[model samples]
Target: MIETVENRPQPKAAPLVVHVVRQFLPNRGGLEDVVANLARQTLKRGYRVRVVTLDSLFTTPDDKLPALETIDGIEVVRIPWTGSSRYPLAPQVFRHIGDADLIHVHAIDFFFDALAWSRLLHRKPMIVTTHGGFFHTKKFLAIKKVWFRTLTRLSAMAYRRVVCCSASDLNQFIQIVPDGIAIENGADIGKFADAASRRPERRIVTLGRFSVNKRLDHLLDAMTALAKRDAGWHLDILGAESDLDAADVRREIAVRSLEKSVSLMISPDNQTIRDVIAKASLFASASEYEGFGLVALEAMSAGLQPVLNSNEAYRVLAGRHEAIALADFTKPDAAADAIEDAYRKVATEGSALRESLMQAAHAYSWDAVAERYIDLYRSIEITI
Candidate 1:
């Protein structure tokens, strides 16, 4: 059995740590999962946890969320916001976090800038986690670069700690804050620990948001190549629609005549996802960008070998973890070749590789990452 967060003795005075993010639950992506897992870890450390988020999801603005609610034992308060989702402006965060001992700003967006600018009024020790530093895409990148150096540089001064979630992020952020530290985004690895088959099949499974940056088109083409080679090769795509429309992906699957071999599941529950992946032996993704490639890591934790896009984070992870394979996702044959090679190894050395993959993922388990955050919180208490 995996060792979970140890139930530490409760503090005499539980300090509140409020997480400020652009969007939370009802949106199941990396940022949301990262914050939710951290909240759970802190709560286990005897800390009072709360989430302050926007009332509307940028994906579906017309659908409004509750103003207040509790999820997984964490209190959440939703605040209204306006402006582009890239940098949503929500000033109402001040009202919900007046009593917080520490304000944990997630991602590099408006919440990050807003709390940093109002440091004097809140007077809370703030720490910001750079979730890929908000440069996921190259659109308007010139303006983003200017903003990062100027306004973002000034905001870094207010943060007690600049927690860069990956080494890639560390390289980008350390220029602004010399003391920036690297922390692996903690994953609920145990949820699907050793969930894949002992002697797995040729089925390929990938899950996450169907964001354009994920390069779903490339993934479809890769699947097309695999299907042409062998009608037996199957692909399971499990994800919710983000900026990319679900209908577009479905239409592409039909256009490529891959509906027979490729299966798609939208926003499945935790158990449902686990069940689907359990039947598959290999995992693959064509994502061109990632904060830390948490889904790929999560799949690794499940004893599934990953064939990932050659993005910086995936390249670094593939470097550190031998179980992962990197491929040129833009080239469909290259991606298909990588996927085929991974399955070949899975068939030949499935049990040994599965164990090795699971062992490697344990290093990034929530049990370890959360301990790092708890230590940081304790250190901050002294200065508070």
Candidate 2:
């Protein structure tokens, strides 16, 4: 039952579309989810899908992933990388992509630039999905800006397509590459569809990486504010290790004296994560940046009210989905008020609100996204 948008004609031969990314599978996050879904959906369309990723997990560098494996009939190749996690160098990428008819690079990092830099050597039709443009953090803003406008723009020229994963990204990058198109990232919305409380209470849940851009500290601050107003307001944090670790989160919770009210589960299994989602009536995030705000949509799919920060992507989403609330996460009290309002709204609307949220989530599934990628891959007209 591989559902795809029809009408687009494919090439006479199946193209081996190789995906080059900084991380995948073992490292669960927005970017990883994007590449995985794209690879899986495209494979079902009869295109050859291959994912080439860095061998080491960014959070736990000491641990290494399998060098080769097959996931959902798609071949995955993991190559070693050296240097900062920000831009780990993996020149070995060229070795694996030799058989690829089209290369899809995710994130504008080391691989994105290097692959384009060495485009002549590989001699493959290439496209890249800009997953937020590396402006996720405030760190080195000036340096990154110069890099984006200069070197990054040059690199982008090598690719036939530059796909921005969010409208915010399109606005930021379109200045450099005017022809770029916005392709919203897809989420596994059914992962927790309508799994929340029957009449959603004051309980909340947040899931993702403990990355710096996630602004977990601000989220804790908001929880602290909410707890002061209603002791019953609890928060369950389900996330993987990233820039922040378990110890850092524990330290934060201890400072707020919220050991009982706030819970943390690092790298929990799917069912376990869903268990928290099942009990939560609200999902909140204090992130200052998101490429496409995929997790918020997933929370909404579970019938949980999303109280997200006023980031560009989130603001755009909230405009489309009225049930979603916006907040100034930098100001904990303001964020707490937004969360309170969301819970109140949930209490009033109940199943009606939940159904609407789930309906909104389905609008961005992988079906149409895969169709677009298929059309782009076939439009290459390059001989294999």
Candidate 3:
């Protein structure tokens, strides 16, 4: 005779999401910014958030920061980094991933294999968010050839979900992996939004890490041309020198004799950035590659007209906005012309343009993004 069996009920705890990235906190980048914002928003939605990252010895100096700590209501664990900065090794990463209810890994790197290993052994639901192209670049082609097999294996078997920050980014990622979901990055609109009417000061501002892709050289050429037409306007390029040396940028400024017309504010604090952007007449970016231009959105939200380089991603995001002036940044004359046009638009329709920019920014709220992520998490199957 068969015996009747009773079903047992299991207790559920608060959902814990562990976000793994190459670097976090103190080390600032577009990837780092997105993770921090999403983590905070996730916490607000009644979920516990934790960030696992490597201690960046190359990018940031050792400040004696604690290995394990909490930042903005999210628990953070920084494992010591070994090997070259281009390819860091973090053996301690395994210890952290097993405890997470759901795992979200970021970027395309050696550590991707670590996450993939954890996924296989722990049998946890995993998501991998590829910020953008890491393989297509000229510098990384050799490395890509060597690691292509491993990368493909991880993409195939590592994660349940694959996410990209932009539609353009998604298209690039899909060339390597068959499927991906586009989840655009967001800016802190409230922090950048200005309530008062904007009065432009004939000043332009741009912010981004110093890298070849940023094309600061091209921007300087455009500024030189702009200075020839109008000496009244000045440009401020504010940001950390990550990939490109600061000396090289200064040398370019000297060659163009744009010392007075252009200046570099290296690595200013967050408040200083807000203050500078708030007073700027125009905001600009000459970046040849952007996963998602969060800084451009921030500048727009702050009521500054944006003069952006022509690209599929920016063009898509700009969406025929009369406020965004697009130009081929490779050509100095073209870039200068676009900047002038954007400046005139701001001068003529300041309040109206500001309103339109705010409307665009409102559509990319972090709260909305958080809700989407929470829904994604709840839908995924996780073992208690």
Local distance difference test, each candidate: 0.88, 0.88, 0.77
Q: List the residue pairs that clash in candidate 3.
A: none
Candidate 3 lDDT over 276-341, as tens digits, reads 776687888888778888888877788878888887778877774656778899999999988888
- Backbone collisions counted per model: 0, 0, 0
- Candidate 3, residue 60: Cα displacement in angstroms equals 3.2
Q: State how far residue 103 of model 3 sits from its true place (Å).
A: 0.7
lDDT of 2 by residue, 131-195 (tens): 99889998999999999999999999999999998899999999999999878888887678778
Point out the worst 10-residue segment of candidate 2 by lDDT: 3-12
lDDT value, residue 43 of candidate 1: 87
Ranking by lDDT: 1, 2, 3
| 3-51: candidate 1 lDDT, tens digit per residue | 4433333354789999999889978988999999999888887898889
How far off is residue 184 in model 1, in Å? 1.3
Per-prediction TM-score to the true structure, in the order listed:
0.95, 0.95, 0.90
Off by over 4 Å in 3: 1-12, 61-64, 140-150, 195-197, 320-322, 382-384
lDDT of 3: 0.77
TM-score of 1: 0.95
